[model samples]
Target: MSEPLDPGPFFHGTKADLQIGDLLTAGFRSNYRPEVVMNHIYFTALRDGAGLAAEIAAGDGEPRVYVVEPTGSFEDDPNVTDKKFPGNPTRSYRSVHPIRIVGEVHDWTRLTPEALQQWRDRLATIAQERGEIIN
Candidate 1:
């Protein structure tokens, strides 16, 4: 039998609050534990300028549903004096790009390639503005 899929810790939150630079705890290419779900992603509104208006205006990119890789630490946080266990990993000044949208929080209907493009365009813009995109 195939090993059970491990999606890691569940993120209990509403997708409504997601914004252009907000971090979304979601699976990468696949919904498997091996995927870096913890890495999270930055969200953008749907294309046609149709989505949360506040979120769209908040970003420096075009209005569209997109997500780009935010910075992530290459190593875990180092334990400091007095502090026993290291807290969450630190954020780096780097980013992984080609903003891929595998799925949504509630497993919303799958998006078409065209729809994905709208997202990509927005993400690309965001990455450029932040100067965090890495080919």
Candidate 2:
């Protein structure tokens, strides 16, 4: 077997309120493209990256970042790794299996309103341009 890509105390970000032991599974809609039902659940080793995902996740609920443990093997996310940012600098991964919520983190840095708006505007532009999600 191949060696694992990352030894992560991984994190998943979302706007959903969740408790410890909750299982985050694949088949959810993509946060970036609602039209796509994701085949894999994505996570990252970088806490701040997860924080950014949580902030931009599509929902009315408050953003949350959860410490998660993958229930099965995972691989580097092709969407960002090599495809966009080379060398997996984002430390992102995706799993077809579920990831269990081990705990919640409360101290992640929040984006400023302007920064958030900038991200929103960027996403909007991508959507308008019909960017592919590499699902």
Candidate 3:
């Protein structure tokens, strides 16, 4: 395990073999929020294989990194936006943006069903802060 680039409760890693339940951070920029750091979990894949390359088709070229729940403090960060929300907020999975893999998550694979549910609930709360629902 290594120290995360940004502050907060998050797991960070180098771009290696990513798997479901792995929490990762990507560098992203949005019109509303620039130089924003987002966290995502590798939920599923469209292709087959273990490493990121395998997730991409033979000719697709683009890394098909499908993830769930992107949470951030954008709503609370004065640097990112003027709007501030104390609670860390999450946007819909549909709002996922193209990002550069900055770090990978070290913990997450051993989550129990109950633990997973708790995480989901937390994520839902964050999403609602953005006025979006996670299905």
Candidate 4:
């Protein structure tokens, strides 16, 4: 008789297709971290996140593409004026800027050209929308 199918991985393929085998799947899956903000949106979109992350890594085993976290405060309101008091500071908020390798880019730049361009174009669009200079 043919050998039995190798029943494997505790949780299969990206919860489905990506789950090829247990050992491999394990590397690809993890429990959501409690410290995660954004309501763990990143965790919920694991497949897409992983794909993007893989693209970012560019096979160099380094995360090339990353959803970067902004520091301190952002330029959320570039219009914030000094017309406010001390407690009422007018700090701009930039949220976060998802970046792909520019100076130190990842190899995935080639794999997902469309995505990278989309990101660039999106920023351009936002800049245009905000009447910001796009040079």
Candidate 5:
């Protein structure tokens, strides 16, 4: 078999308060598309990327980044890899199986208010245009 694309100390981002050993699973509504339930749980190798995800996640709770370990096979997130960005520069991946929370990260960069507004504006535009989330 081919080697894994990344040897990640993988991270998942969200607003949910979770404990160490908590399991993040699939079947949640898409953060980008609330109408659809996600079949895969996504994570990234980049801490800041996860932070961005947490910042934009659909909730009012505090954003959080969790160090995670995938419980099964994962693949490059098709929503970004070779689609919006070429070749998984984001180092994002998704798995059908659950990912366990090992610990929390406290030092990821948080976006400024203006920057956060810009991102929200971008997401609103995408939603208005009905952006395709590659499930």
Candidate 6:
């Protein structure tokens, strides 16, 4: 039998208050444990006229989803955080092109794609198993 995958994420909070950037930050900080390098990194959002509205008009810090591939530090550490959403949201940053990183949010993200995928796959399996997703 194959070894079990890690339990991905529980999402302790609600999406009601969560925004796009919230998801990103939280995803990055998810792998935090004892005696780790903490990944020692930062992100710079891609700025273009397309996705600037939501970011600018955000009450304080609104979230805009985006399609982000491993940009930086992806090569440095195998743990460079990357998240994938099959059911892309309408409000997500356009094509993941014009991106923007919200100023200093919470240190709330994880660093394991395998675990993330495991959880995502499991959740979908459960939802499909229960017919939560309509065909």
Top lDDT: which candidate number?
Answer: 5
* Ranked candidates (lDDT, high to low): 5, 2, 1, 3, 6, 4
Candidate 2 lDDT, 1-135, residue by residue in tens: 887788888998999999999999999899998999999999999998999999999999999999999999998898888876779998999999999999999888899999999998998897788588877
Q: State which candidate has the highest TM-score.
A: 5
Encode model 5's per-residue lDDT on 74-128: one tens digit a residue: 9999987986777999999999999999999999999999998899899889778
Prediction-by-prediction clash tally: 3, 0, 2, 15, 0, 13
Per-residue alpha-carbon lDDT of candidate 1 for residues 1-135, written as tens digits (9 for 90 to 100): 544222122121122444554554433421112223334332223222223322323334433333334233222212211233344222111123223333334332344568656766765575556533211
Model 2: per-residue Cα lDDT at residue 48: 89
Greater lDDT among 1 and 4 belongs to 1
TM-score of 6: 0.23
Compose the digit string of candidate 6's lDDT tens values, residues 1-135: 543122211112111243344333222221122222232322223222113322322244433323232222211112222233343222222111222223323333432557546755665575456532110
Q: Per-model C-alpha lDDT, please?
A: 0.32, 0.92, 0.32, 0.28, 0.94, 0.28
Instruction: List candidate 4 stretches off by more than 4 Å.
Output: 1-42, 53-61, 64-111, 127-135
Relative to the unseen true structure, what is the Cα RMSD of model 2? 1.3
Cα TM-score per model: 0.23, 0.94, 0.24, 0.21, 0.95, 0.23
Where in model 5 is the C-alpha error above 4 Å? none
In model 1, what lDDT does residue 70 have?
Answer: 26
Instruction: Name the candidate, 1 or 6, with the larger lDDT value.
Output: 1
Residue 67's lDDT in candidate 3: 30
